[model samples]
Target: MMLSGLDHLLAAGLVVAVPLCGSWSQRVLERATAEGRPDARMRDYHLTMLTLWSLAGLTLLLWGSAGRPGSLLGLMFSDGMRVLIGAGATVLALLVLVSQWHGISRLDDAGREQLAAQVGSVLQLLPQTSREYRTFQALAVTAGICEEVLYRGFLLWYAAVFFGVWPAVILTALVFGVAHLYQGVAGVVKSAVVGLLFGALYAATDSLLWPILIHTAVDLQAGAIGWALRGARRGAV
Candidate 1:
């Protein structure tokens, strides 16, 4: 389906808006944490994302209706086999990553320190308390849903309207990586790689569900680990 000029304009607006919003959100998080209000910051961050993605989803639905009714749902749930395969692959990947955490002690001192530093960098964003951890889990789920909807479902579809599918996928993945600039270079690279995988899953299944499940699982595990580390550090102090 070709996008009208108006649709293109709207798509361009979203492409610009999303990254800017991400940068703004990072700043908000930093400011809130500096003020000793991480929980409040997280709540605000989740609320903002929920609202932003909800509007993006609605806009995409309305735009997509010009092509076919229920096409949006079809796009998000096309192939069960593909979804299953994607889910299985993601689970295996998660298991490997988690297992590595347990084997950190087997690494040399330099490797262990490097791994710890990487994990510590990520844990900075994790909630430090049980109450906050529950909220963090919800945030992870929300991120999985909303981010896939915006980046994969909405942005990819819009990009495909202009560029071809492969071009759109690469462009969308690059943007996804850039959105993680706050996470540093390694984070950006990791995010882009994961984004590429998620894009492949979406392309394979023609469905958002598979990517959403994978993204949520990965985020949940990271959050859990970060929370545990934070608690341990506090106990030691």
Candidate 2:
């Protein structure tokens, strides 16, 4: 699809805007922390959900206004073989998530400490209470749907206007990674790798459904693991 000048402008705005928002949020978080505000992270969660959903809604609007079919965003169902492939990939991902959860649950104190150190950069945003965990769950679901739409669907299409499909996939994946810069270098690397996986999945399946499911599963699993580890550390203390 040949995107118009307006479309390019919108895409550029989004590419610049998301990371800037993230950086701004990080500053807000730091300031809140310095001020000893207890509700800072919760507020951050709410704002993040709002931003992601808004961006996703705008993307849909832009696509519709451009007379683009939903299929172009990988919203339509594929053939039987594609469905089977998506299903198989989803099941495999679920199995892997389950295994990872099991391994995390069995972490010794030392192991937990090591893991904690690795994730310390983003610990401020992680859930500590049941209510926060529930909120995080909602965030996970929102991110899974909205992010796939904005990044995998919209950004991929936009980038493909300049780059070919495969290069667009890679470029979008890198941009997705940059979107999580607040998580630190390790987080950026890890998120980028996951983005590549999701981008590849969307490319291969020609449907966004599988990537959305897997992305949600991954986020949910991460939240559960973080919550469990935090609880374990508290009990240990």
Candidate 3:
């Protein structure tokens, strides 16, 4: 195969580490919430951001060491179609932002609590304060960049060496979903489906630009939804 032994080892390690870290972080957040720790969510956000960035750095280092073209990692828009798709994705993201802001701006007290209760399983991980929400926004952006790079770009490329392109796409998507193991079974399923969509997007467009934009927008929308719901819950107390 084209992959070195070192590459295999690193890939295996990451597959284990990502889900383990996610599950552990969720547990920590739950415990902190139970204990009434004010900074629990913010701390979790910070740690997660650091972890994602670090992993992304490792992927970049490996790419460079292999003397691979950066373009291989979906770093550039090399065609008019890619550029058009990127522009369309950007516009879609802007629309999503506007929609989320509008929805949050219109939530009444009951509506907020009702909406917040919908995400009850992981509510504790959501931001309850303005500062936490701000930090979460940053975390969301970081995740969009790092996750797309690591999963769709690097992991897909690496997996394709053994599995071929289409199989690699599916495998990377499953891995991406599993990495959200902290979300539990249903969450894992949902995330996996989303991951599949992202993988397909990458495969179709042959670039990460639009996928990154769409991913960031999805996270930003989720954060806004959580903040709206949490704000209501906090007020109710």
Candidate 4:
């Protein structure tokens, strides 16, 4: 209920970044609009109008984690485990890149069509999502940014700082897995795996920059594909 100075400081640091990241995302939209992208629908959420609120709550969580019995955060920062986890991540990513490459090169016409049908089937299972108006878009953007900082920045950092690199990675993955509890077991498992992948990337790269870059590229591709498909379906219908 009552937070001390360090708690306040950490919370302030984390919360402060949320708004900064959120605003930065909004500015990205503005810049895109300037270039004639004009995604009016994706620019309306007020809470996410280039800022968000999340400090006290996250601070408390981090503070609690600091005193926890086990801390993967602690482990991640250790001398040996850090390198091991980091190296593991890099190797996995390279393999993934290769697999993706092979997949693309190996697909034929019928294979592509069958893959398309499978993708369509999977899309049918996605929750009936709606378009985020320009307003919600900003908020969604804020959520994306803040959520990343909250989980990766603070939580993951905490685990690595307190636990051990390996422990931190595993603990963070568990936390990440739980975060997807709403998505069911499959979602949880997938998210957990992704969290591990991201954590490993962070460990290997020693910079959030690469993971963030990779995330941006992956998201952009997915977004573009979705947009193209939607437009094509609309035209056909």
Task: Give the alpha carbon lDDT tens digit for every residue of 83-188 in model 1.
Answer: 5776676688778767855675356646544554666555557777787778778878878887787778777877877887788888888878887777777787
Which candidate, 1 or 4, has the higher lDDT? 1
TM-scores for all predictions: 0.79, 0.93, 0.90, 0.47
If ranked by lDDT, best first, what sequence of candidates would result? 2, 3, 1, 4
Q: Spell out the clash pairs found in candidate 1.
A: none
Lowest lDDT 10-residue stretch of candidate 2: 228-237
Q: lDDT tens digits, residues 197-221, model 2?
A: 8898888889998999999999888
Tens digits of per-residue lDDT, candidate 4, 1-237, equal 233566546544443543355446545654654575534325424433333344424543665665732232222233466656555655665566557655744666565455444445222212112553223333434544454455565556655655667777677676766654444466568768877877666656455544544444343333333333443333332
Q: Which residue pairs clash within candidate 3?
A: none
Which window of 10 residues has the lowest lDDT sum in candidate 4?
120-129
Off by over 4 Å in 2: 232-237
Cα miss at 54, model 3 (Å)? 0.9
Candidate 2: residue 77 lDDT (0-100) = 59
Flag the better candidate by TM-score, 1 or 2. 2
Q: In candidate 4, how many Å is residue 157 off?
A: 2.0
How far out, in Å, is residue 30 in model 3?
0.9
Give the C-alpha lDDT of model 2. Answer: 0.85
